[model samples]
Target: MTTSNQKPFSYIAPGAPKVVKAGGVANLDLPILNLATNESSFGASPLVEQAIKERASQPNRYPDPASTDLRNAIGETFGLDPDLITCGNGSEEVIDGIARVYARPGDEILFSEYGFLQFPILCWRTGATPVKAAGDGLKTDVDNLLAAVTEKTKLVLVANPDNPTGTYIPAAEMKRLRDNLPSHVVLVVDSAYCEYVDDPAFTDGLELVAGHDNVIVTRTFSKAWGLAGLRVGWGYGPAEMISALNLMRGIGNVNAMAQAGAVAALKDPAHVDMVRAKTDEARNKFEADLKQFGVVAVPGAANFVLVKFPTEDTNRRAIDAHRHLAAENIYVRSNEDYGLDDYLRITVGTIEECDRVIESLQRFFAA
Candidate 1:
């Protein structure tokens, strides 16, 4: 009994938590130590700024639709074939393209229990069911994910060095996950925070993609490169997967400025190394300081730390701490949306910023 005037299907709106932009608060003349978003404290390279300025004069011209030069630069940096790469406004856009190309209505998209929030949103947009596999203390449990797989599953998204919790599995575990999955299923390895990890055991999904046609690895310039404002991300996969993504992605999705900035950013390895070194120093100190206050900081490989409050009334403690920090113009992400009501995800800031946060927390707890 379908009515001619009625819409075909109901639109499922996203119910995720509101992302707080610390910049907005900082703009109000507040002395804010903004750490909500996991952006690089060091800022984008000088080369990136110069590139954007250089490209500014050509604002009227359309970007290269194929993102040819940018792709080539990325491929050169990673030692991959440019033909197997596809660029997007952000990795999220590429994820959307993957869903559109590979997932159909009645299909399922699978991810870990506390994986990236975008994974489920992408699934809903593509009319696919989002399935959650249980995790082991915020870490992706490969066995749980494999067990959750059904014949209906079309895509599996794994955010290595995952956001919020910031945990990751080793390369061998990742390989095992890929090897066990059905060949028809596409496995997307989201390595947004890969550059921050110095772990020898970790792999950024390049090796898996080299041998497996069903594997795709997505990276972003938003993290260590500090080009988040430009929204540039790229994916490397088998030629067939890249082709499928390119077909669904909008032409000129990556603008001229972003392309130029990304290319320049890639050429400066020293900038990235400096940012990583600073992040490691700050993160270690911050964790140690928090532990002195009885806070259990999750040992993660990413640039952000997931801190759990030690109290029976965990949620209240977290909320109180958050409000206290906000009063001092310091911001951190509350994890209520990710079923982690008792924790806060704080980005690793500069040394002084980290010290300031630690000092503020000490006062809040002492009171």
Candidate 2:
């Protein structure tokens, strides 16, 4: 059935994101407060700007394909071996490398219910089926995930402090899942939001990889680091695994400016800490405010909180509230794609911005 001009069956990908956040395209009378993508309310460290300014002049040169300096900076911050770290455009690319290296047609990639939306996309990219296990409400159930593993399952993905739902399983449970999984199957722990989690029993997945050769942990600078525009992320695992990822990762995936900026960002731990504290404070206040308004909200460990709207009695449903806020030039995430039609995920913004959303939603509820 294959033809010279026809597309490969494996080339299909998921549709583009239904919500567009850039460009301020939506016409509104008020100033835009774009929080739809969970970007950091605080900008990156001042050092990052300096680094980018210096690197921007050399646009003619190619980046270091190995990302040596960036990896060294990451190693210094995390106490990891620079040799075991592999950089990518974002953690998404590392996930893609993992998927392509381990999976193929007829194989399955297991993810938790309400897992990160990108997991299915990566599965499709590798021509593997995406299998989801049941969860206990919004939290990922480790036992259900372990039980769902079958002979065809090649990889398992767990996004700690999971996106959208903003829930995370403790380290003990994550280890249990890995212990029960087959030795040949790979386990990937995505810790994109780890900087916001203060749970004593939770992990960013780095510890799990130390003793297990089959485990890889990925991290990103997009959240608390305030570097979403830079698209810098990395993976830590065994040296052999890192080698395989380098082969699959596009050459110079992380550009020269991203590398410099990420390196500078790592040097300013105080800035990241300040951002985390502020995010936590803002998220807590948002959740409490919603509760005061008789709106159901899920307590979260990440930078965003999920609020459930009353769908039965009023026209002020989640989608309606989302549009109402957007019309006021305040955008929050709507979760229709994740089958969470009744919920909205609000990224923690500055106190003033969060106050604006609260006021806007309060009016929506009253009207």
Candidate 3:
């Protein structure tokens, strides 16, 4: 069944979203709303923008491979040990680094079925077998995950405020999962959307990383910090592990501009607050509107809303609605690849963007 035309490996999706390929702005035929990726609609922080502008003059020089200054900045802000942090091109690279460190042929990399898309892909690409546990109503079933682990399991990944679904397992549950896992297993808690959560029940993975050698918490400036374009993300773990990852990953991993922008973004608390407020408002409105239309909405702890439509035809309806919204300059993600064919994952945009999507949805369903 092997085909010569096929590439030996394809780690990413087939192609970009259709709307992106077409040159036109959001239209009926070419609607341009992008709720596909949960990027911050608020854009990069002003502090980051100014820093990037200032740093732009020195692009010719290679960036610091160690990223010592940025690491120190992160340590100062969060009280983390600077040596424990490893900055990467993005969280994806960090995940790749983790896979590279822990995985080999016959090693098992485990994550929830409802977890982020990249975890399994990274595992497969690194020669590790992926063992997925079924989720409970879009939330990761910690019990199932623990049951699936075996002697060959080397890594376990849990994304708090998981992607597509935006579901979270509480701090107690996390502790339970940690206790249940073997000490040799590396736990990766992806808190990419952690900044949006106000609940105290959810534990910050940073705090957990301090006590556990097996734990690594990965965070990104891509979400609430609004630095998606810059592609800056960092991983926090035991110093030895971080050192190993950096060693294998080589030097000059993070660029100067990204390092500069992330430092400024971390310093700008006001920007974080603004993004948090906007996301809360938009998510509330989007969820309420979906409920009125009889769509089943899973409880979301992140900045996006997960709504399940009535049937697989709703997938088409969602696509049609996405096209209709693009005509009105709005966009959302259809979760076909995630096995939720009847569902859509809508990122919380600004108030106006939310209104545009809501209005477009109303009109589409009405017609």
Q: What TM-score does candidate 1 get on C-alpha atoms?
A: 0.91
lDDT against the true structure, per candidate, is 0.85, 0.85, 0.79
Using TM-score, give the best candidate's number. Answer: 2
Tens digit of lDDT per residue, candidate 1, span 1-367? 0012211111112532222333434222446566877777788789988999999998999999999999999989999999999999988788889889999889999999999889989877989999999999799999999999999999999999898889999999999999999987999999999998898999898889877889999999998888887999999999999998898899899999999999999989899899999999989888888888788888888878999987775434886787677666677877787998778889898878889888988887777
Worst 10 residues of 1 by lDDT: 1-10
* Superior by TM-score: candidate 2 or candidate 3: 2
TM-score versus the correct structure, for each prediction: 0.91, 0.92, 0.89
- For each of the candidates, give the backbone clash count: 0, 0, 12
Candidate that beats the other on TM-score, 1 or 2, i.e. the better one: 2
Q: List, residue by residue over 1-367, the lDDT tens digit for candidate 2.
A: 0012222222122532222223545444467676777778788899999999999999999999999999999999999999999999988888888999999989999998899999999876888999999888898998899899999999999999898899999999999988899987899999999999898999898988887789999999988898988999999998889999999999999999999999999999999899988887787777778875667878668878888987785677888787677666676778888999999888788877789999987887777
| Candidate 1 stretches greater than 4 Å from native | 1-29, 313-316
Question: What is the model-wide C-alpha lDDT for candidate 1?
Answer: 0.85
Output the lDDT of residue 16, model 3: 27
